[model samples]
Target: MALTPPAWRHTLTEVPRGAAGVLRLAGKWRAMATGPRGRGEPVMVLPGLFNSDRSNVALRRHLTRMGYRVEGWGLGRNLGQRAIGQDGERLFARIDAMAERYGAPISLVGISLGGLMARIAAHRMPGHVAQVVTISSPFAGPPDATRVWRAYQALSGARIDDPEVRALVGEAGRPLSVPTTAIWSASDGLVGGAICRGEDCAAVEVRSSHVWVQFNPDVLRAVAVALAT
Candidate 1:
């Protein structure tokens, strides 16, 4: 028999909280400069599934104020397999160009599905990527464990269980030569907390919903700490 679906009550609560977080970002935009900064090394921020670079505006602004040269993947919207395009040649090319521009390996900070992309990129070209940090990314469970699976299918027209998707999902648990940090949240509405923890990843926990994690103060602090390491 199929198991009963988990309660998504918390997920529903995220709607208002996410909106509030966006407002908080607008008010505190300038204060971001007061925090600790990075080495001005290149940091590329990738958005979650169905998200465009616009969703990461607050994150990029904070990171930029922290003295890091950060850029978003210019790709319009993240479309699962389609975003990678033709064996991920387009994505790889982006990584390669960043590394070349900086004259050193680049750090990647990805949210949700974007996190999975970062991990794969790091593994594929460890020489180009310095480290990877994933926020609210499910690394220890199947794709179905995520609340967005159905929405993902609806938006991308790709089966969550397809062979290629399965292979990419499996890569989440595999360790990479470059440093990796998985920042998860117990309050995440979309992804279960347990599945976000990966055996091969250095884990950090935050108290925020999956949607607002990108703008959560604690999450921002953790991302900085991860990149500074």
Candidate 2:
């Protein structure tokens, strides 16, 4: 079973209130030091909901340097909806093409809604995906745990109670057949940490903001390690 709000929120909410700025600066410094070295199989980095390919450029660059062929979803922007299956199908097709081009299984590194999409793709096409990594993704529940999330859902025409959303979340509860890792922060101001847990998946806890997860050193390290495996 997943943790309750009181149990998880206390840990996740404390950092954003106090040391967020410091962490952000540290994250940037780490990115500069890590530089680009590049190694593993090809990787697809997907941005969060409402985000664009540019949003994940730094992370993708780092992964490229780490010896991995990194690519971003060419989708224009993320608009939160349960019909994400359409986008997932397109992304899967892209992954298939990349696999053919690279001649190796692809690892998916996704944030927020993109993570859910990656999970769906991996579940449906295990032979094509080698591993999956997610940051601040709500795998086990809706994203609208807070009032701000509720507001965003309403503004974006995303129905939190939509049947499709419920089904997606439900699918997340089952054990993933592919190797999976989830990187979460104690400072995510968006989705509750309770929804980040996985039964058989390796979960790494870090200190970073929800918005800047892709830039955090700890989160990046966790993703790199997961992909390396």
Each prediction's total of clashing residue pairs, residues at least 3 apart in sequence or on different chains, is: 0, 8
Q: Of the candidates shown, which would achieve the greatest TM-score relative to the real structure?
A: 1
Structural similarity to truth (TM-score) of each candidate: 0.91, 0.82
| Candidate 2: worst-modelled 10 consecutive residues by lDDT | 2-11
Look at candidate 1 and tell me the lDDT of residue 44. Answer: 96
Q: For residues 1-229, could you state the per-residue lDDT of candidate 1 as single tens digits?
A: 3322234886888878676766776676566556566879899999998899998887887788788999998887998878663448888899999999989999999998899889888888889999999988876678787788899888878898888778887875577788888998777788877777676778998877787679876677788788877
Error of 1 at 77 (Å): 0.3
Could you tell me which 10 consecutive residues in candidate 1 have the lowest summed lDDT?
Answer: 1-10
lDDT by residue (tens digit), candidate 2, 127-195: 888888988887866555532356547545756677776676666556778889988765566666667
**Alpha carbon lDDT of residue 43, candidate 2?**
93
**lDDT (0 to 1) per candidate:** 0.81, 0.71
